[model samples]
Target: MQTILSVSELSKTYDSRFQALKRINLDIRRGEIFALLGPNGAGKTTLISIICGIVKASEGSVRVDGHDIVADYRAARAMIGLVPQELTTDAFESVWATVSFSRGLFGKPANPAHIEKVLRDLSLWEKKDNKIITLSGGMKRRLLIAKALSHEPEILFLDEPTAGVDVNLRRDMWQLVRSLQASGVTIILTTHYIDEAEEMADRIGVISKGELILVDDKAELMRKLGKKQMTLQLQTPLPLLPPALAAYQLELASDGNELIYTFDAQGERTGIVALLEDLNDAGIVFKDLHTTQSSLEDIFVSLMKEAK
Candidate 1:
């Protein structure tokens, strides 16, 4: 796992006396899908923009594949391709022409064979000659991806890649992302879809209020912060929790017909045995019980709230 991109003490400040990014430091591993999750204006896009040379950092340094982004701009930028959230293609230009032109923008030699392969991989080969305005929204999204791959960049940035797409198209894009990773592309994903990050990212980075709050392997992050809840369906509704079960701090739900207990999933002991024993002593009976583990969305929301 080589470090392909490194950001050290990076900061961005606008002229309006607002800080968009706050001393951010991150290292993107080679060939890994890293999902950057955050709320609107959480600096996800700002960070990506800086790394892709679209925005200048007010302080600190960034190196892409050992090339300083500022001093060696061309070399650093040449290794990266960006698929912006917006669809800003030439409406009158054919798909082939737009994609071909993108490759040339990076100062790369014309490789028609590579361009054809990218189009074919994105299922845009048949529509290569079609004008951009004539394509469907889904096709246009795929064409954006094709343009990003046109330059054969080592790193690809997908900024809200599936923003307005349908479920099926989102799934297709997920598969395409996986294929790109398989082809040895380091992908930086900025997405509002938590489930997409949970499904596609090898590692997750959560940012809030211009700060990188957490970065961890997806599974590890879940297991470390995830909580579990046990819901017990009571045989009879109670007006209130018994004094004897006060230590458990359980909540009454469904108008007292249900009891809910929340605990850390990684805790050494859940205290369920003692809880049930006390419940029986209080003449409380549950007909059924079920448990649910916290999801990434739950963790993400909790993190954001805590950051606030």
Candidate 2:
């Protein structure tokens, strides 16, 4: 895969007292949905700001589409679009006027057709004539997206794009993100919603205390870190796990109604079949069996705990 954005040894410091970001390095793939996951003040916004030229790096360099963001500010910025977390826009301006004005700011010639397409794609066409102050929170977010796309940027940055959005609107936004990727636009988004990142991101990057901790393909990351649990509802309550089964490292529920087995999902052998056979040999019976895989939320919490 081609690299659309690269960050090398990037660091951010304020007043030379607080370090917001460490020496972080990342490569965002072209035309892919990359999700940046982090807690509040994890430097996600700072990193995005530096890449978009809003904040200056304390040290290191960033290149967007082979253009250095600092040395070639115009060209690098022209290839990128940013929808910030805040809903900052011309309060009195109509959606159409605001979007058109953003395009003009980028030195783009007036293209009504392109503007109309962006608005329609974001479901903002009907609200185009309405003032920003009159729009709903969700609509305002869409307008931000519209304004970002107005310039026809190759890379799009979505900072908490679906924050406070309803379920239906979130789904619509997810679909729209896919449509944008299909149109050859690279997307890098920071989101607090773990499920959203799990569902939409091709790759997941985790940041902790302003340091890039992990970056891996979504499926690969899950497989690497995901754990599976097997629960067996026993027909007969066992006060304790049999000594013979101790080597299996099984856990006994306090109620004695179930036996739980924890295993790595990436392991070649889950040992469930052997455990079942052992139970049969021991004259134990199970009424039912169930299994569950760890979710992205679980992984996120675990990572945060480790970082803390």
**What is every candidate's alpha-carbon RMSD to the true fold?**
1.8, 1.2
Task: Give the lowest summed-lDDT range of ten residues in model 1.
Answer: 262-271
Write the residue-wise lDDT of candidate 2 on 59-155 in tens digits.
9999998999999989999998999999887789999999999999888999999999999888889988998999999899999999999999999
Which consecutive 10 residues in model 2 have the weakest lDDT in total? 264-273
Clashes of 2: 0
- Structural RMSD, model 2: 1.2
* Model 1 lDDT per residue over 1-308, tens place: 89999999999998986899999999999999999999999999999999999898999899999999999999999999999988877899999999999999988999999999999999999999999999999999999999999999999999999999999999999999999999999999999999999999999999988999999999999989888999999999989988888888899999999999987767789898888888898999999999999999999999998999
lDDT of each: 0.94, 0.93
Candidate 2 overall Cα lDDT vs. reference? 0.93
